[model samples]
Target: MACRDDDYRFLPIVDAISAINQNVNLVGVVLETSIPRQFKGTDCFCTVKIIDESYSSPGLLVNCFGENMEKLPSVHSAGDIILFSRVMIKSHCGDVNAVFNKKISSFAIFEGKHGTQFLPYQASANFHPRDEDNKFLDCLRKWLLNRNPDESISLFGLNEYLPLEDIRVGEHLTLICKVLHICKVQENKWMAFVWDGTDAPRANMRAKKENEIENLPPLQLEPTPLPRDVLLKFPTIGTILRVVMEDDNQGLQLLNCDRWVKLVNVKCEKYAGLWRCMLMPSSKLQYLSDTEKLISESQRNYEKRLTLKRRREPFSVHLPPPSSMMTETSYTEMPFVTLMDVITHPKVTGKFKCAVRVIAIRPFQSEDFCSPQGIYRITLTLEDATARIHAFLFAEDSEYFFDGYPSDRTLKRTRNALLGVMIPSGRSNEEQQCAQRNPPWVQLCLKSYYTDKNDKWGTRKYRIFATKVVD
Candidate 1:
């Protein structure tokens, strides 16, 4: 479940097959990786096993195809060493077959592809004696003996002052290097080059003749805003809106977004789960101005995001929501009650069942949805001697309670939480009798309706309808 920091080592691509195929999780270095017919129009993505000092078992390999592979820069050729972290697990192959599961962690290239330890000092534990596997151990001895606190040295400490003659194409540079450019990427493998080189490589280049793809750098372009005269946007359920978060210093702005939740005010980081999703014309975003603490903390987060640590700015007002804003909220956040409370007082967990006292209620109207279903409309909240939640009765239960029960004609049992109204974002969890209806790790939103009362298996009355939480 975790990669050992001390086990940080590189492995050869050849040795990881059995482990990868067998499902042993690991993290290793890239010994040799290349995509055949590099530059095929549509790049290939694949996984393979690698060989290295970490283990002999087959490890995992990841191949990024097309432009996606361009993100991986090749640092060395065959025999060029690499470093990585891998995990092993079980995975299903395609739709019909099952395969072993093992995965790799981070991957990067090095200048000295062979014969050298990346961090000589830490590596000296096993790399001393100038052995074949520990060819790069000498540097650790030199670095330790040449320590100087007052002198300014490059990021590599004393490594930068060393002449290029001390480093070679195949000689691996252990310092963490970034991918400057991707020379080639293919279906099975990706090629990368380091950024530390004094010279710049080709930004875009064609792969081999067998490759159908070409490399191109990503472009950044800002589009003009839509003119106010050009309105008439049909509201959508998931339309995204942009809100630029401001830096406290006022030097730069950072942007984030959420579904068009109607904004009533200008606020940031209010509730535990609530986020400030820009304001708009039809919303009441004015209430957001009440949050003073959140706005101040947000600025500090914004400043770090804009890379403005050195830059300063004057005090400024966070921008208000535009007149043309669309707000959207998810049904998932709405809370629902448990059926257990109906059979038991404090709780109705599988072991103990209890009955509950009904409260207020509201039935959803058909007019609320564009193309609505009656199932999701019923939301309720109820409380027993112990706790509370939401609940709803389906067509069968509603018809039976209203018409079948002839004995109850003398009294009316109108209710609130029992009718299935719920508070948004509460400790609501739903358990299902079958796997098909299993919920997620956390609370789930209401979805399906009861199609058949016969399938209830006597658990209906004991179940939850919906609920509302009080602040």
Candidate 2:
């Protein structure tokens, strides 16, 4: 570890966000991040706020865009550090902001901790750090250790509770919901299914196809999956959001299935045509008691839903009940079951008849439907008034469902046909609400079984069989 002239390449000196007067390099601790959304074609865009010891009270806003998400900064927590090279500062809508320059700007992110060295956890393709950068990082880390946690909370501004039903995509807000199931997806990723006894707005499927499934780490749910009984307890009506939690997230320590808790600094976004929530590094989780006012509010909502159900006319609703749409299938005599009944049945391995509407299709890419080995694979998220569950159609089953291998051209038409509801932008709120609460139903044969016979608790699955789409 000796000194060399070649190693001392000239790098732009770091400038404070407050003091920067021109296009320059800067570094600061990440305080907040908006959901990364797809821009034109394959590009990604997001808004982030950062602060340093020099300007900690009023953080600087940055509009970040990248050719792809991999090029964008991944700030896992509030105290993480980001380094921007050759960023241009601009004023927009009466506020000063930093904009990423595609041609010249590069970025790097480092874990912000007291003793962590000058190594970056993520960086662009062609980024190199200067010798002076190490000392700058050291200075910021020490300042962060002495920073007040309360000050950070005020900047986060997550005091109000947003019911799940009222949440709009792309907004970072707090929520008070009940967790039904929690399980590890991978070593560093966890998934918690939560609901507030109210349904989310209609799922929007008009987003860009290429951005449907952003490249991220795989969600490996096979190992240590949620127990079957616990999964069955998931609410039948209303929305159940999949909340992703990172390994280092503080909420991971406090959250458990079946508890009512408050989620602060959570961002809502659409994933695979359905709404999903993310717990950011700056996010916090606190458990609530039964007597809390928020709990009472949620209870009243649930009661209101039951009242609507009792008052609504059976066949007059926009979406009819499953029984009303039941078809004359060959498995009709086998005894039809609700989506909830299918999962809670004692048999664990049998064919059951049910009526459900297709809510979502995955993997979003048509190329993913056909494997390189020429095998077909598709999963449909089906919903009934009783509950929602994923039913698979693979190999021959997929071919039969589509009459043959489905091409990219016919995918949308087929998906819409199966979905039964194509919500347009101009639909009235009353009509949209009616459609979301009651979607048309279709009859099918669903087979339930455990993936591993030896392990019955965590390996249960459901698949579609003897079901074909007739033109």
Candidate 3:
């Protein structure tokens, strides 16, 4: 087990610190390893820090650059002991580091009871002095076996904020970002654009399809119809959110696991006189001070944008203006039926006007029978003091009211657009239009009918379809 005097000696970390630019060998336990990042062309590099308890100095940072990075994962891990040979001692800006020489250096990893195994490297055979290398490896293995696993040198528990550039595919990370835009793509899929206060490109964070509800973070602020209600109502440009994220092939995404993300609520007392003061309504921003007024203004702007965007396209048939067809009339002129009247008399089949509050609007796919080509429908949940009922809007009517249709040309885009309108903003264009023309409540002029057969609810229900949004 004795080594010859000519054999290369492994230096202590303290000795390696003083031997800048000199080739040295050292055995240390891997403490931390960074994710591999691409440099020029296809070349990748990773940084690793290792600690040696036998030395009096601190852990040494190892820069594993070039093609040798391919073997890094297999060579060592957080708890493994590695023997680095012919590594150049490097120093810059008063910080010392060990640079692995990919062309002439080699490394051996001693993990668990696997003894010693040298990884293939350039000129690896000529660099190893067999007897001396084996003796050093054996001694290091004994020292590792005698030590407790918990007592091993590690650099965990140091929570540091990682920049967007440092994020890599398949790495779990936590980030604080601002919500830029939100769109609902499907019944369960919600996509959001976020910026992490960096110059990096905006990232897309999507709600995971599976375990969707269970994984959502608890709202730190008061409960509202939508998450980040205030931000969604007003400008979504600067709403801060703290989220736990993971990178996939698509890019950085919200972590699908439960309780991994949260919306950090700003406590006014703790953040007094800070930048968050502008975000709070009780403070100085004049326009944002009134919640009702801000929501009303935001709703108007949203409708205007949606209307202008949809109106630019050519339609198969010319549409009439809202004022021309659905003129406001007194209650006696229309004989408006209350929602309770229709619910109580399920067989009611006649034109009746009802003033009701819009609760929810969703894209409807009818299962009763086949719908015509290029025809789309929407079901609006309307509530009055008496009862709640679903009113269907079909084809051209749906398009006129909500700017949505099921035609092949605009099916997908229209569906996504309608969903986005319903989700965060809390009001559809039809609802807003109705509210504007009629204060306190909106009236729907429609015909109601009931099928002879009973449904799952065990009763033949009355169905209403709006022909116009009457005042």
Candidate 4:
């Protein structure tokens, strides 16, 4: 069945980036630059890197640009997630001058009049994206609006619900707003939405003098910024939300702010034009406050180190060897990637020590064995990159990895993840015998699905088999 408002949970931008191809938004830290969102609102974008061809070579090169180039952010920091929306998309025919593909990116400069938001977020004990629920989703079918999406609502004084009355732009606002009308964006214009939520005095019924406006000097106000509370319309950035809690008996509460859960997965959707809910929380599991505190601390420490490193070093004349590339330092410097990228890409070798998800699994076969030892390959893209390319992690690495780990989950602490070890699927009986006869007949294998006492998955990582579909 298609999902309704109540059937989905918010996905974080970080999580969404890994599965970006599904028409979902790619979320990551916003790259700050003076270019201004308006300037590059339209253009091509691409990311590139060098790799060791086989065991050795001058260096294998791969660059994504062209049609794919339309997705790049010229000013985004290396570690930031650049969400592309409402842009012309196409693959590039490789720039002759550029190394690899000259995948230039192009997109709207201003990310639209919409602005920043900081709604309720359930930071993990370590502040990473959390997935208390493991169900898959098809698309956002409903929404949990703090106010009616279709109504022109008034902003009652601010934060009326909280005991504090001091109004701030970034603070979470819970006010009693009344509906007047619904509006939308017209050709490059922000649609005017009048509000009558407050009293006639506060309700937006005032008439603007048209002639008086024409006399005013030309102004380039950035945008009519909405408070973070206005973020309810966004499925990702907010906290635990209930888009369609229970459409049947607990029908839609267009005006009921309490009906909506706050925190959410900022990763699921792109930061672009308006979109309805695709997923909503299945449960209201209380996040341990301590977890949030710890996550904040971890982020702080990580950022502190990053800040120091940026000030300490510069460029590299030669690329680091691929095998020895993945490292603790690389994790922060580069955007998140799959194990394949970590191992294959000459630049991203070590960072993937942890942080990957299992999206699918090809069941381990008996024939895949080197002298009775199992081997397997896990396909994955970086959990935080717009790219969704798969990679391999070897059986040796899987088995030799830290103790008591779920082979199906993202490798521990490594930002790069692809479930299980990367090993060739020795599908042919002849290939199996050739290797087995030689001695170590490397056969591929992986522990795909494992569950805990309540039939819930135990690993932070999950596999989404090709045959499977998000609900």
Query: Candidates' TM-scores?
Result: 0.19, 0.44, 0.36, 0.19
The number of the candidate with the highest TM-score is 2
Query: Model 2 residue 145 lDDT?
Result: 67
How many residue pairs in model 4 have overlapping backbones? 98
Report the C-alpha lDDT of model 4 over 340-406, residue by residue, as the tens digit: 2222332211233222223222222212312344453433322211112233344554333322233
User: Candidate 1, which ten residues in sequence have the lowest lDDT sum?
Assistant: 251-260
Error of 2 at 309 (Å): 7.4
lDDT of 2 by residue, 1-471 (tens): 211224332122223344344565678877666545456676776666777766675677777888865566666555677887766777666777788866667777887754467778888776777777787788778876665756544544434678776788765588878888766666645577888876665544433323324432122223453566675676545667878853333224235567776676788886644677877755655445444455777888777755663321111234454345523244645645567667677777878877666665677656678788988787777765445677888998777666687677676556656755455779875664445322345777888888888987457788898776653
Model 4 stretches with alpha carbons more than 4 Å out: 1-351, 363-389, 398-471
lDDT of 1 at 209: 14
lDDT of 1 at 75: 28
> What are the runs in model 1 whose C-alpha is more than 4 Å off?
1-32, 36-49, 53-60, 63-67, 73-75, 86-105, 111-471
Model 1 C-alpha lDDT per residue in residues 288-343, reported as the tens digit of each score: 11122333343354355334421111111221121111111133333222222222
Ranking by lDDT: 2, 3, 1, 4
| Cα lDDT computed for each candidate against the true fold | 0.26, 0.64, 0.42, 0.23
